[model samples]
Target: MLHVAPSPAVAGNRHRRQMLLPWLDAEGQRRIRESTVLISRVGGLGGPLAQSLAVAGVGRIVLFHEGALLDEDLHRMVLMHPERVGEPRGSQAAETLRRLGGPHLEVHGFDHRITEDEATRWMREADIAVGAAPTYEERLLLNDAALAAGKPFVDAAMYDDETHVLCVDAGKSGCLRCLVPEPPPWRADFPVLAAVSAMVGNLAASLALRILAGAGPIPWGELVHFDAARIELTRVRVPRSAGCPACAAAERTSR
Candidate 1:
């Protein structure tokens, strides 16, 4: 549920441009204002994702990323600056988001990875969950938590020169586990370019907003892939695996 207040007058002045859109009038903008999004790992993809959602006027954003900023992260992590290279990424990101998001938007940052116990609480509280972690282990954890809490999960990833954006609508869509039951055998670290990550991050945010506001024809269980080298975009529908542990369990319980 969105944390919306029944205000007679909409704050159209702040988001006038968005309000002007035919689908997103005062009511739609208000929906965005009342929504809460939980974004995990505010590094390459998470950085721009948080920024885009803030600009879109999402009511609240809760970010999770544990570690200090690295010099290398400056290239892709938009929330990071060279001056804060050694500072905590979560705190730095939260502070930056608060400033960029203005006073109306609520921002919370956790400097440690969300525990299994904490995952459900945060997922249930938020209207949406985004997985932007660099490792498949972390991404899988987020998927489990989001599914358990009955929240939609948006995943964005960039590898080499290719990027993938996917959204899992819990029971209705194929989840991360459904797509990849096991983590890839390759090492976690990979080559990344800021330009590519930022572009994919913005697309992920756009999909999230569409799902949240019910404004556009969201992909739902589809995967949106981008190949920067070839400059091509592809959409592929992903089907749910009947044997998927996480989603399969949910299905059995519901029936």
Candidate 2:
């Protein structure tokens, strides 16, 4: 059911030509071309992640982000333009992706954040969900939606020079709620570097591509941490919390 369309010829497409590696062959590329990914926020982290997916041939992207662009957001929002300031961030991001991905890629841009009431409806249209919101509330909402829809979820976040990426495969892996049972205190104006945000976003994109293409075993439930300060990358398994209300409720429903 994931591969909804027939595989298109990849012969002369320059964007996908370079991606033809042993790990991701023509069939893999076709899979990528048919997948629809939902991104929670098209800001710092989500900007690069959506751009990478667009260029890599994702068939569609659903973007959700509230508010108009501010001058301060340009430092890390790669898809946003200075001229587009005061414009809706979601629509601007969608326009940028459409320009990059050409006519084949479809993008639905919402000028508001995904609400609890709308989560299930949106999740039904996506094959996977990626969360890059600054707030734990949004990330956890996305996690619950993805789990309920039986879709993979990737949680990407960064603070200053440090980055964190978590890939969850619904019932098979721990959800975001498992790692943070209660919402942690976080600031909306978190400090971040452009380069570090892009690095983590691209990393999350790569993980997403692997999952979409079925290239290899997914690192589900693993927390990938990158410390730009020390130039270190670490991976640790996140054990599923037995008391996680989000995933636990999902597990019970599956039975």
Identify the candidate with maximal lDDT. Answer: 2
Model 1 weakest lDDT span, ten residues long: 1-10
How do the residues 5-123 of candidate 2 rate in per-residue lDDT, one tens digit apiece? 22343425655554657678888888988898988998989999999998888988888989999999999899888898998888888888877876677788888989886778878
Residue pairs in collision within model 1: none
Runs of candidate 1 exceeding 4 Å displacement: 1-12, 252-255
1-255 per-residue lDDT for model 1 (tens digits): 113222244344677877777777767777888899988888888899889998888888888899889998888889876797888888888877876777677778888887677777887788888999888888888888888777788999999889998898877789889988999988857899988888899999988887778788778888899999999999888899988887865465346
What TM-score, computed on C-alpha atoms, does each candidate reach?
0.92, 0.92
RMSD of each: 3.6, 3.8
